[model samples]
Target: MNTRPGLSDTEPAPCLRIGLLWHSVNSPNLGVGALTISNIAIMEKVANELGVSVEFIVLGWMDKSFPVYVQAPNVRALALNGRACKPGGAFSAAVGDCDLVLDIGAGDSFADIYGWRRFLYLAYTKWLVKRAGRPLVLSPQTLGPFKNRLARAIAAFLIRRSDLVFARDRMSVDYARDIGVSRKIIETTDVAFRLPYEKPSPWPGPKEKTVVGINISALLYQGGYTRDNMFQLSIDFPALMDRLLDYFAGIPDCEVVLVPHVLSHRAVEDDLSVCQQVQRAHPGVSVAPAFRSPSEAKSFIAGLDFFIGARMHACIAALSTGVPVAPLAYSRKFMGLFYALDYRDVIDCAAETTESALEAVTLAFGRRDELARMARHSAALAQDRLGIYEDGIKDFLASRIPNRRPAPVAAKSRLSA
Candidate 1:
């Protein structure tokens, strides 16, 4: 095993080369879509402290029309165009000369339909590493229930062979254990926790009234969950926005702002549709424009009296800033995050949503003091857990790649020798 001076080590060090692997560049919610971006941002800071050089390899098909480039210093972005690189070619191009390969999970939207294609990407990467006989580390990632047997087998095989495994939650830890992945398995929080907090909103407005914020995703509508027959739910969100305006109508000074987390694709359009419906219902309700940076989004969320959203990161942004949040969970990640934070009481999604969302807001208002306390505690917990992830990455590198020279002896000891 190799050893190097990481942040945890008590010695100075040489620069290290690190490779980051991810699937896509564009994301509707900058928080969710730019997870790799967040990871790289944190690593850049850590690497600078530890004297390491970092390079990013984004593995997926490239659209020449929409070339994506990571905009960070000392970081090079490699786009392995899908057609030419394929899985094998992408893996080789990404990890060929790197000292350590950090395998971030692939596009999660594909997993929504129980698609096996996501597993194929992971399996192929592992195959490449084994073929080259190099070390590969699995970062804090979300594993699947594996609806397809072939996908499950492939995932299991890869998990078993990885040099290191760090699950983002307890559920992932259990899943890996169940599949007989006996490698090092540790639980850590999402890497996004390390991202810098966004500043407060600059716009001046009445500071007394509670500002209710909602981040809606269009994916729900497209997935048929919005249809009355499919989900047996009648919350025509656009219409419901009107009802909410009516509900809050007489409350003096209270205002509503609909924030769209996804600003592009069908999801963005869906969010816009909901916004338009709300605007039609109540002509005066103010709506914020799509935010471009995670910092700006976080800052906006921090000023909210309360937040309700289908997107996980929207809620996370609120929580990260000490604002009370109620998530309209559309996927397991939503439930997983709440459970990880031990805030299952705050989430209301799909069938469980409805008036409960209103009730949660009321509770958030009533228990504002308690919620603030909990938020402070949870934020600290998030910070500590993130430290574990940072330490884990450095330790993995130190153990897998030893330092070239041994520790120096004291001058007195050397003289005796």
Candidate 2:
């Protein structure tokens, strides 16, 4: 270890070790992939510009046997499941050398809204990071609508101890304040907004017609398909999707394309199958090619004239690419993100009736041109917001390096060398 006490204003600090935990880089959800890659790229750029090397210990490597999508020489992927199995053995050994720990938390696992199991997993990970005696940073992600008392307590405990917590939207910031957290909290936009998008040369459908992209979530489709919801509000999901397809199909010179944002290795969990079912039901409707990465999916979305999506990331992929979207929001995360972007016109599946959702979708489709213009402007602003997050991260890293002059011993060694 370089034992220099502090970095000078003129010179770069020594190598810094950072461990980024709690995000599955290889998740079927391409948005997760985008976040993972963006986080590493941002940190690496900061380190490189400062003339310091960074060793990233990525704790949420989903499958070590398989190649990680976010590949870098400095990034080391340690399987989280394997680490959990070994308990203190692997996690402690892997993270012991880290100077700081960043809990990315897969965007929105900080609360127990999904279930108690997820909350427990996140709590345990935060506890481990806190125990390491390093500055624990909560990367830009959604905080909570923690209904459970125990869950709220755990979240408050972990968040209070965080050196820095970057809430992706104002709602999350409000959430942190509601939970009585006094820690340093900065409201930032989703890092995925900064993901690179390339426009496809020949758009997926006919050039004469408008290309509308639809992304369906299999998880949502399976949970009672509308009249029944895992939550209180129930709109038949499949019926709603069918209605949207029929409405668009009736439009002159409009092409409907089913775009799956998640292609799980597991057959049942995959969005591709759900998209196919929709395609089969509608004769002229087409299914987009299975995308290999988030950037690829975003690129496909870039080719669309309009997008209506059930998956939050797919909506993100669309909005980030300046494609107009009528997000079928099933959770608060969607509302919060769109709210931050100042982009309204969302169809809340959990709150709206089938007729209301259909009306919203119809209005969105009819005003696609105006919505597209707004989306482009919003995306430009969203990308700009990422700069704030970058600065925050850089400052956090720099703070860890003391401001004092290099130790006499280190200075002597440098002089001799």
Which number leads on lDDT?
Answer: 2
Where does candidate 1 stray beyond 4 Å?
1-15, 23-26, 60-69, 87-91, 106-114, 179-182, 201-206, 224-246, 267-273, 348-358, 400-417
Write the residue-wise lDDT of candidate 2 on 1-417 in tens digits. 333344456554466778888765566777777777777777777765554666677787484332356665566667676446355768777777788888888888778766777778778877877776777889999998799987888899889988888988888988888888877789888887766667768645657888888888887887722324564455878789889888987888989899998787655447999888878889899999988677778888888889999888788888887789999988788888888888987888998888889899989988988888888887888877888888888887776655423222211000000
RMSD in order of candidates = 7.9, 6.1
lDDT of 2 at 284: 91
- Least accurate stretch of 10 residues (summed lDDT) in model 2? 408-417
In candidate 1 the C-alpha lDDT for residue 99 amounts to: 69
Best candidate, TM-score-wise? 2
**Clash count (model 1, backbone only):** 4
